[model samples]
Target: MGKRYTVPARQGLAVRLKKGEQVRVINTHGTQVVDSWAFNAADPTEFMSMEHMRQGINGIIPKPGDGLMTNKRRPILTFLEDTSPGIHDTIIAACDIWRYRNLGVEGYHDSCTDNLRMALVAIGFPVAEVPSPFNLFMNIPVRPDHSIGWEPTVSKPGDSVTFRAEMDLVYAVSACPQDIVPINGAGLAPVDAHLEVLAEA
Candidate 1:
């Protein structure tokens, strides 16, 4: 078993993954939405891109065995396994303070975008513009009316999704702090998540 790392509630964490290695992210409470991103270790600018991934996968939600495409139009991580309902999102932008402001939050609100920035800085990586993350376990289903609904995750406790590193890269996760919305759950409470990096078999 690999050492497990805690992604604190309302915060972010980042780790390095070498090519061929795999990392599994766990929804410890089954209620948190983890916004996730991967960046090339050699070039942070070449990070995961949801737009490209949608084009590559021919869908919005990537399934197991899909290669997550990067902005450079290459695979960054390969979706390996999903023990959840596979209700992840690729269309929403990482939540930011501006988003909270619009929701009538007067003060600084913990946001996934800020969490991503801080997490990268903690790992000594240059902070860059927030990319559209592969929102693990997040549920934003498109309706027949061509609109979307922010629904709670359908994953159960201890559910996880695993990905294999396509190249040496930095992976980040934010146990999203979207308290104003019910996306995390009906409770609207964000909680901790976990991850483990596995060595190549």
Candidate 2:
């Protein structure tokens, strides 16, 4: 069995993945949304790009067997498996301090943007820019009028998604701390998630 790591509530964690290795992200509580990112181990500047990925896939959300594209227009990771309802977001920017302030927060609130930085720094891999994250299990419904709605996650407990590293990479995830909006769940509570690095066969 692989060692499981916890992505603490309202916090972030990062891990290194070699080529062909797989990482399985678990929604332990099934009510939290995990903001995920990837960067080339060789060059931090060549990181995952949602815009490029969407253009390559010709779709909004990625599914199993899809290669996650990078800013350099190359594959960094491949979606291998998903046990959840397969709902994720590639459009929303990671929440930051300004986002909280704009949401009328009085003091500091945990944000995914900061989480990503802290996680990378913890792993001795810091980047200059904060790219938009792949919001795992986030439910953002686009209405017919071209509007979007924030909805709670639809995944049940123990749901997970697995991805394969197409190249050596640094993977990070933040247990989103958005309380003002109920994207995590109707309870508006953010919780810890788990991840396991699987060996390549």
* Model 1 regions lying over 4 Å from their true place: none
Kindly list the per-residue Cα lDDT of model 1 for residues 1-201, writing each as its tens digit. 389999999999999999999999999999999999999999988999999999999999999999999998999999999999899999999999899999999989999999999999999996657888999999998999999999999999999999999999999999999998899999989999999999986
- In order of appearance, the predictions have TM-scores of 0.98, 0.98
| Model 2 lDDT, full chain set | 0.94
Query: What's the C-alpha lDDT at position 146 in model 2?
Result: 95
Task: Give the RMSD in angstroms, all C-alphas superposed, for model 2.
Answer: 0.9
Per-candidate Cα lDDT values, in order, are 0.94, 0.94
